[model samples]
Target: MSHLLDNLTVHPDCRHFRGDLPCRPNKTHGYVCESCPVYAPVTSRVLIIKLGAIGDVIRTTPLLRRLRQERPGCFITWLTHTPAILPQAEVDEILKFDFASALQLQARQFDVVINLDKEKEACALLNTISAKEKFGYALRPHDGVAWPQNQLAEHKFLTGLFDQVSQANTMPYVQEIFELCGFDFRGEEYVFDTHEDKGFNWNQLPSSGPRIGLNTGCGDRWTTRLWSDEKWISLITQLQQAGYSPVLLGGEAEDARNRVLHATTGAAYLGTFPLPQFINLMHQMDAIVTQVTMAMHISIALRKPTILMNNIFNSHEFDLYGRGQIVGPNRECVCFYRGTCQLGTSCMEDLPAEKVLQAVAATLPAATILR
Candidate 1:
């Protein structure tokens, strides 16, 4: 069975517990209490540390659910950076920290601590956590060499380690990571709660049939992932003619591109808002048209129809999210995994505007279409 399906089969049954059974970390033979003094039945408080971009944080939520399920009475605290986008429901306490403040906090001993960062500083922080059992990714040669030197990629590497230790090669996706850690994955959904009373101003949006959100800018300036501004403008015009309001959504970095697109085609440009507000705004839209970014993942979680304009290699990861239309070149574009497209032409530019418009039309609700 696939790791995903295998996870679904093993639902936690109350009847299985026979008067405080020994805690076995995994399917391996050794029992925790038998091996060491630190393994005694203690307060099962879990500390999960994953602080990074919006997309990576979203992927880590399922792990939280899994930890909560297996250790029912355990107190779960997540250490994330300020302005970190997350689903409010998953964490019991969100300890926001900066570099200086993080080093000073009292180190309360934890039963289990999981570090998902990939930088040297993160490693130092992991060592500081007063935990009996600590789980993190094993260091690899190719890992932790990014511009910011993230230690979090180490967590991804650790997934492979766990697989090897368990004598299994197939590791589950982000969802199954949490399931294997002991959480029920069946009914869990990605959620974002905006505590604001007024919520998003729908009136600011164009009053038309089927509004579609277009995210033009990614976090970085890698041209490989970006569709041409001209193509985006052309696509917006086509969608407008097709009786769909194409609202442009992007971060501050895309203000120039948004202006260019707006000037070319009078599309409604919704500049960057906070993550919660953006999610709230998305809840009102019919579908999302984006690249391989956090917005695409959010759309998938919301179950809103999405048309992803992605490179060939990264498309597989997005495919795992399920329920989306992927638009890219017919062939394996040479810029598949490269940070920046070295080839003179960007594959995203090769995707014609009409093709994307067709995808949007097909995915949007028929009731939302104007006659």
Candidate 2:
């Protein structure tokens, strides 16, 4: 596998810590392992720290699978803010921490503490953990730290670190993290084990035809990623005309938005359920139609057919979650990992309702539609 730097030109600021720091070898610094104390190779007890958005948490599932497989006996723990989003089989323990109380998180220790969060506080907390081996992105230029200024770069850097240690080239960057930790890196996609069976009442739902779960609301900037109410109404009308039931799902915060959407089209909108219950609900759908968010991940994890309507700044890495459908604008979306679109016209808006509906139909198999 090629190093991250090999594929892309390094930013000028990244040169300072090339070989000396934990980053890939470039003009910057050298590897930091020489002076760093080598922890005795005891049975692995891994702790993965990823305090990121819901979509990001879902994307990390492959990493978890790899780590568990490499060391079957190793105890793996996950430190994440949204523990509810993590699949049931990913880790042995889930340590949920609030960013507001980050300092208190240092109390727990493990054999290896890998910090996947980008915030400076996450780095500070890594220092506090009593783990024998500490690995994470370098916020400031440390004598032996890796620096990744952006989200895509960070993913590449972290995966490179795992590759360096494990010498595994077959697995992707995220999966490499697990392989490096001595875990199996194949199969078992992202999964959510919801205790409550909030799945749709098949009897209550129209028993006659295919059901497509429509999910709006990206949670942060509501207006940017979502289609207009009118567009949703049109899409629902078209789907219904084509013999499909569009089940609307979203958070309580989106209740009003969904109400307007439902009222406009007379669709069955199940608004604002709890996280676990929402996931359970997802299992009932034949396929999911959603914007780029946790819903896409959840639907994919459940093995339900899905169609993701993405914005300009969408990350293709999300495709790793499932063999689902995706719809987006026809324009060249330059902002791959930007938190928000800088361009005046958000790319998602460019996607026509007809185009989205067509993509969905094309992606779902005849059997899936019949089911």
Candidate 3:
């Protein structure tokens, strides 16, 4: 038994190696670590700590492409609250935020640790992690609040705190994150796996016209971003009149309202789905119409042409990848980043349906235009 134990060897640095079980090559072809021809070793391990609000997670995927270019032989582990939305193939391991996962992470060490989220928990995790190099936010030792780890993160940190600085800032969210990690954002496209959904078939959707997905909710947290129901009905009617297929999209929060929109405008409403299936559903559309929500980020990641309705947030913060338009209200928004409308009425009310309709026609490919 001692002799046998002495002869055993393992390669933890191999990307295919699973610490708890047999590696893929060994399981599939009985390839031992000593003589495995397909062995791929990684030079370093990296951890990405982005916790929640799924939209930010989707947008953060662009950093993966940059990371790969800079460090071709690095293995990545992502700690996220919404692990289901992340591309498993792109990342070596996706960890959901729970007590067990936190304990597991605490025991392990990484070559590089990056935390883009400023949440107290995220900063605390960054502080606890053992890494050769650390970037982005960290928990301040005295106050127990989030603080920038380095100078690069200061710009993004300040922008979030001050409305004027955010409004005057020309850097898009992607560029800011890239700079935070000491890389230039050269229009690196989002890395998303569109083939994750296996259950749904979208054959029933109209085959003639270009499918337009109208993501109709801004979420409960941001009531200031909601558009009037009357405006959505008008836009759907106009799309049908122009020989376009209008489909409503949302999560459980927006389902009842979406059903109402479908009934009122005779538009297609293919109910809410899991995150992966929701991404797949968005992939079927040629273009999308949405406010500043998860759907907007998903649409951008899927590379669909989009017309983004805006009012509360800074328009400059969004990078549409030159494939979409950001249409703000005619009346300037008084509530910049506030959740509730300070003016008693949302500025989205001033954004007319005809304007959004024109944006839709302008955004889609010329061949898809029916009128």
Tell me the TM-score of each prediction against the true structure: 0.73, 0.71, 0.96
Q: Which candidate number has the best TM-score?
A: 3
Please, what are the lDDT tens digits per residue for candidate 2 over residues 1-371?
A: 76876655433322222334345442234423333232123256777778877767776776655565566557677777888777655466676777544554566557777777656666666666777766654456465344653343444465445533323334444453444344444655764565454434445555546778888677675446767777788888888887777888888767898899888887887666667767877777788888767787677767777787876432434553455667787776655444566786666767888987886677664345553
Off by over 4 Å in 1: 1-43, 99-101, 104-106, 138-155, 158-176, 179-188, 194-198, 319-321, 369-371
Better of 1 and 3 by TM-score: 3
Global local distance difference test of model 1 = 0.64
> Tens digit of lDDT per residue, candidate 3, span 1-371?
36863688777779999978988899999998888898899988999999888999999999999889899989999999999889888988999999998898989989999999999988998999999989999999999988999998999999988889999999899999999999998999998988744867987676778889999998888888998889999989998888789999999998988989988987998888877888899998889999999999999999999899999888888999998899988888889888988878888999999899889888884356442
Candidate 2 or 3, higher TM-score?
Answer: 3
Model 2 ranges with Cα > 4 A deviation: 1-42, 87-90, 98-109, 138-188, 196-203, 320-322, 334-345, 365-371
Ranking by TM-score: 3, 1, 2
Q: Which numbered prediction scores highest in lDDT against the true structure?
A: 3
lDDT of 2 at 135: 66
Task: Give the CA lDDT, 0 to 100, for residue 217 in model 1.
Answer: 77
lDDT of 1 by residue, 279-345 (tens): 7787777889888777877777677788988773444344334455888865467764556767777
How many clashes would you count in candidate 1? 8
